[model samples]
Target: MGGESNRWAASGRKATAVGTIAFRQQLAYKTDFALRGFFLLFILFVFIQLWTAAYEGDFDKAISGFTLKQIVWYLVFTEALTMAAPPLCSRIEEEVKNGDVAIRLIRPQSYVGYHFSVFASEALTRFAVHLLIGSAIAWPFVGPPSFGGGWLGLLALSAGALTVTFLLLLLVGLCAFWVEETSGLYFVLQKLQFTIGGMLLPIDLMPEWLQRVCAWLPFQAALYFPARMAVHFDPALLVKQLGIQIGWIALLAFAVNRMYRRGVTKLHVNGG
Candidate 1:
């Protein structure tokens, strides 16, 4: 029994190794990723032109705490951050519907852990790609965002944001075990994140009441906090937001794990 357990542990490690490789493989298409960068560049330029025009007639130099340049740069960070997240939750939905998760069930590995390893690897890769390309494009316009506390905090917050996002989506994916089709959930999740997480719009620009309400949601912690800090680094706010990010990540991790355990049990009972 002990030997069997040892072999199982070894196999899980092997599965994790494969998960890591799979994520790296996503980077093989250099041309495709570069084109994606250009697409974002085009959008950034158009927004820059629009905002520049709008602000041209304004006597006020800043709107809602952001200058014309900062507003555009804020979008630069948030768009890249929102886009960096993989849509693997939909993949989970499809696999569950098609009964393909059965193959994963017999493997001597934690199914959620295996996929999350893949998600983390891919997310980090994509975040790097997005950051490099976005910065390259933004430099000619807004210049680089000031890094006050160095990149250590930035990287930490980015990782925390991604992890929290993955965990929330993992929970959504686990719901597929029962729902079989999670299109509605996916749609709602995407829209809510886009609107409330300050992906396409900066939360700083939102109405005071709306901002107060959004502050309590995990959505802000997942994307807005990190992205905001990227464009406007503040050591004091970073310390406060980092604590909030850590809290959300931990809480969401526990929730995802709980839902995963419940999902596995249901999968076994249903023989799927």
Candidate 2:
């Protein structure tokens, strides 16, 4: 029992150490990081301006279930939180191609566990430095949208959303093992999310057939559904969204495990 406890403790330490290293590495480029936040703010401001122009004649009318203000704020939060989510699979794929992943595999920790720990640490740093700061700067420009739920409910939904994001991205990253490069695939998948996942336009605005298609897709569970929860809280709807989110998480996890096993055996590490 003591040995088992000791082993667990050691593993925890390793994970923590890996995460810490990643955090510090990101922190080292603080200036460039700050610029990225500025860029996000600039892009967001432009989006708002364009929407304002487009809706000038119809300001009084609600388009697609969102008032201008609500849509503006939704874009703010979406842009802020979206980038803070980790890009682990991309990083792992790069390492694999460059022969760096071999080092990770040789370590005592499992490769996926180690990468996830590092990615989580990086995400924490980004959330604090980029998302939090961006939100603060944009707050005065855009008043906070009314969050309908209690604080506890909001937190649960936010955390659950982040978990779903990580799991989905991780699953997508696993494709690195099978595909030669994931850039094109990631681009297409992300754009589909923007269009179908209700990021670019609300699902309510989408045609009935499109909404039906999105209902089954995992993308909506990633950004759109959670963003909806933040803006409008319906307990029943939250539960339904969470149920679907968990179902996708489980399915993706099973698929990832299968792919990772196959990848480990077939991965040809040519020296880059």
Candidate 3:
């Protein structure tokens, strides 16, 4: 038991180190970082214009229980989260095609753990950057975020949302082990996230039937739940969403582990 505990501790330390390196590497690309922030700013500006027109320049007008300000803020969070996601699916597919996974699998750390550490680190950094830029652009037009005391809860939920997203992407990437091309699958996943996952619009505004369908699917846990909580926070809602996020994370993580175990067995490397 002691040896097992020590092994776990060592693995944790290794993951942490890998994550830290990934975070620093992300920071090193100053030009890319600036470009990402500029892109986020541009997106928020466009959304503000669209929403303002939708509200007919009346920021106080409520649509589906969301004021114009709240809607913009909601978009800010949703877009930030969406843009912050790393291209894990494409990266994994490429690695598999080029025989890189063989090298990665021989490493001391778990292959999934190594990739997840890198994904989480880079994604969290980009998320923070995007959020900052989006918030700066939205604040002048929408005033301050109304969820004043719930900032910590918002951050926690956002992290959970990202984790769920990462697991889904990992599963998609692992599909490369079997099919050898995952771009079509990844494209479909992106569409699901944009529509049913509520990255482009809140599920509340959708038809009741669509909302019910989203509720049954795990996609909303990655985008809708956290973004909705950010703009319209309730302690009870937070607790409920957190539970939902946790459940989705566990289920997706289990699926990822199972798929990875089977996928790794089918992995083949032809060239040096």
Candidate 4:
């Protein structure tokens, strides 16, 4: 038991190191970082204009339980979360096609863990950057962000959302093991996330039937719940949302693990 515990601890340290490396790699690409930041600003500016028009320049007007300011803030958070996600599916598919995954598999760390570390690091870095850019742009227009649930709650929910997103992307990427291309699958996944996942519009603002449908899907756990919680957090709702996020994360992680195990067995390596 002691030996097993030590092995687990070592794995944790390795994952952290891998994540740190990935984070630094992201920062190394200054051009890409600047472009992403600019793009985030543009997106926030467009959303601000659109939402302002929708509210007819009435910031205090409430639409579907969300004041214009709350809606703008919600969009800022949602868009940041959405844009922060790297093209993990495409990266995984490419690695699988080029046999890079075989090299990864031979490494000391678990292939899935390595990918998860990289994905989490990249996503968190981008998320933070996008959030800062969006917040800075949205602040003068929308005033301050709602702090109904406190910063800790927002951070916790954001972390859960990112984890859920990574697992889902991992599952989609692992499909490359069987299918020659996963881009179409990823495209569909992205659309679902933007539409029903609450990135494009809050679930509460959707039609009742659509809202009911989103409630059953895991997409909301990744986008809608966290964004909504940011704008109008309820303590009881936070507990419920966290519980749901945990459930989705558990299920998605299990799927990712199973897929990786089965997929790796089918992996073919050539020329060392």
Best by TM-score: 4
Q: Clashes per prediction?
A: 0, 0, 0, 0
Better model by TM-score, 1 or 3?
A: 3
Candidate 4 colliding pairs: none
Give the range where candidate 3 is weakest over 10 consecutive residues by summed lDDT. 263-272
lDDT tens digits, residue span 145-197, model 2: 55557333445555555666676676677677667577776777778767886
Reference-based lDDT, each prediction: 0.78, 0.71, 0.88, 0.87
lDDT of 3 by residue, 3-80 (tens): 999999999999999999999999799999898889888878988999899999896689999899888988888988
**Candidate 3: C-alpha lDDT:** 0.88
Q: Write the per-residue lDDT of candidate 1 for residues 117-162, one digit (tens) a residue.
A: 7887777777778877777777777656654543555675788888
- Candidate 4, superposed: residue stretches over 4 Å from native: 268-272
Q: Pairs clashing in candidate 2?
A: none
For the record, the alpha-carbon RMSD of candidate 2 to the native fold, in angstroms, is 3.0
Taking all chains together, each candidate's TM-score versus the true structure is 0.86, 0.85, 0.95, 0.96
Of candidate 2, the 10-residue stretch with the lowest lDDT total is 150-159
The local lDDT score (0 to 100) that residue 23 gets in candidate 3 is 91
Candidate 3 TM-score to native? 0.95
| lDDT for 151 (candidate 1) | 55
